[model samples]
Target: MNTTSHTVAVLGAGTMGSGIACVMARAGHRTLLFDVDETNLGRGLDTVRGFFDNGVRKGKIDAAQADSAVANLSGTTDLGDLAPADVVVEAIFEDLDLKKETFGRLDGIVSERTLFHTNTSTLSVTGIASGSRLPGRVVGTHYCNPAPLMKLVEVADGRHTEGWAHDATLEFLDTLGKTSVVTKDRPGFIVNRFLIPWENSCIDALESGVGTKESIDAAVRGALGHPMGPFRLLDIVGMDIHKQVAMRLYEQLREPRFFPPPMVERMVAAGDLGRKTGRGFYEYDDNRLFGS
Candidate 1:
């Protein structure tokens, strides 16, 4: 992909997908955000608008800039429209098989030179590339949640991912105000290598009744100097996502430390999916929690 004037396509227009699309568009790149579901496509647009509105309200961006940013971004439910894109980044579900299928199809649709990126957190980039027609072109451009705001994009180089592709992806991410960290395509890579396990252990601590929710949160924030406690972070990350990513890491590494504790599974099963569901370790009052 030409790093200069490439049209970027972000598949799966969820929160992360939309945020990435917005950043690319704001950076003067033509962006197309696509999803198979119309509802999700619509929601993605709403999400982008809401985010820009917040920025405008906060005096971070002017209305004209927000309007132009929105104008540069377009969305669709069709994959055919993505054929002309120079780079296609899949920010869809965390499932390995789904990403593989999407990448395989993108390889056929886009030019062979187009860069394929997966915004996957834990899944194997090698496995995703294994299913692609051009394994060498597949690169991991894993972004944190709130993609437009997060400055780091973990650029993973799987065994099969081409060196050139990694360099190009790192450059692109850098252009979008992201700090790219290169690492081998290992489960959890670097950030999550330490983070996910820590969060999982915190859940175990809570499940084991180590302390009350408020006490745990206060200790971490006040004593540990953390911006947010593990449970609060999990609530923002969503309980279901935490459970799934934990399982993926545990299964890949076969390490018990990475295991999603029973508490998480039980909570997800109970439908208390953190902030989104208005409850998890703490209950949400109008999406804002009162007591921990």
Candidate 2:
């Protein structure tokens, strides 16, 4: 699909969803961002606005461009509003049943030509598509966290995904100035295949008193030239999400290294969900990391 001339509907209004909406809008597509509640939809819009504002401040985009992107972006509380979309991307929670249910509902609402994409990082695209009326139209378009800044989107072809659907998704993402890698429908895909295991190891080390979070993060930063250490990345990704992904990968790959450590479970159980919740492996005040 030529997304430039079409409308893109993004389901869910969380961080990833809102950020993906910004990317679509900025790419000159009329983007409809949908959520179940008014507050989440409003928050998603605000996040898009904030991204544009920051882009202008950083000279990444001019005020005119920002205005145009914002003009192209709209928020909706009704699933029915997405019927007119040419492409629908689901950025809901990481649960398989929930994703399948969402896609099943969307099948009834959207046109058969409307391409269905899921922003699932670990779940099977084939499994999600199995619940859809048109499984051949479903594909996985997994955008990394903070989608507006992340340039790489993992495109996965499910067992039933048609060649045209996969090709069109790649073309659409390319038009959005995103680099994509095609991967078979598998747990964790490429980036997470390497990332989740490393993170699991980092948690194990932390739990074993290998080093303090600060020292370990600093060592990785200074020695390995990493942008952020595993712990900090885990915190940013949300400890609960980290644990969930780890468990999923472990279950599928049966790799001991992918298992979520006890510390991660305890932290998630404690409701320390990282930046969003103001606590996780580290403490945050207003989303700013204050202490370990």
Candidate 3:
């Protein structure tokens, strides 16, 4: 868990994984981004490149700095290629059994000292770690969506996670210029615990005809001073992902507020998966919300 001179491997080359890899590379780590599919790995690499390109355009980073950061990132389709990493962060789908199976497989490939971090917002860190051979080394480093821009990184300790692992994760996040908050291994950590329920309530409101999606979003933004309303946030989070998270939290806590509303499930079933799918509670075109 030395912050300096570490090789980091990020599994799953989706939005979160790509953003996490970009953050690590920008922080001067030699980062390897991996996905089972070559196309996904390619797309993840493209996302990292796009982030750097945008940084340069915005004057947040100079050309040389962006170039160096981009150079620090590499992609691989082979999980075996991750053995050289000092730390491995899994940013895959938010399925408990899938995460456990992934860690179980990695246990045979990675070194005993290689710290395992799961970027899960809802699943139990203890459950994921229990499948690992080095359970004490497994920690939760839940980065907010769009990891490169978001400053908060929630670090959680699993039931078997060692103190050093927790400390090291905080230190690592600090090196990446992220604010790390320590929380117990629980459903939704902290932000999602409050945020997801609120989102579900918003959906409920929409279904009950209390407000139009845009009107509700505007009301929350104007009245509550939230940058984005719950519906907009759900769109950003993806309807499918929101449903999964709500379902998991509901299953764990049995709270009605955590249950996904019927509209959410219907939208997900319709493949209107927010920005990624061009529609959700709202429609989108070329990543921009339609008409705004």
* 137-177 per-residue lDDT for model 2 (tens digits): 99999987767777889999899999899889888998899
Q: What is the lDDT for 26 in model 1?
A: 78
Clashing residue pairs in all predictions, respectively, total: 0, 0, 0
Model 3 global lDDT (CA atoms, 0 to 1): 0.85
Worst 10 residues of 3 by lDDT: 283-292
Poorest lDDT segment (10 consecutive residues) of candidate 1 = 283-292
Better of 1 and 3 by TM-score: 3
lDDT of 3 by residue, 58-119 (tens): 88889999999999999998888888888899999887898999899888888888889999
TM per prediction: 0.87, 0.90, 0.90
Off by over 4 Å in 1: 1-5, 208-227, 281-292
The regions of model 3 sitting more than 4 angstroms off are 209-211, 222-225, 285-292
| Residue 161's lDDT in candidate 2 | 95
| Model 2 stretches with alpha carbons more than 4 Å out | 287-292
Ten-residue segment with the worst summed lDDT in candidate 2?
Answer: 283-292
lDDT for position 173 in model 3: 82
lDDT, residue 12, candidate 1: 84
**Per-residue error (Å), model 2, residue 250:** 1.2
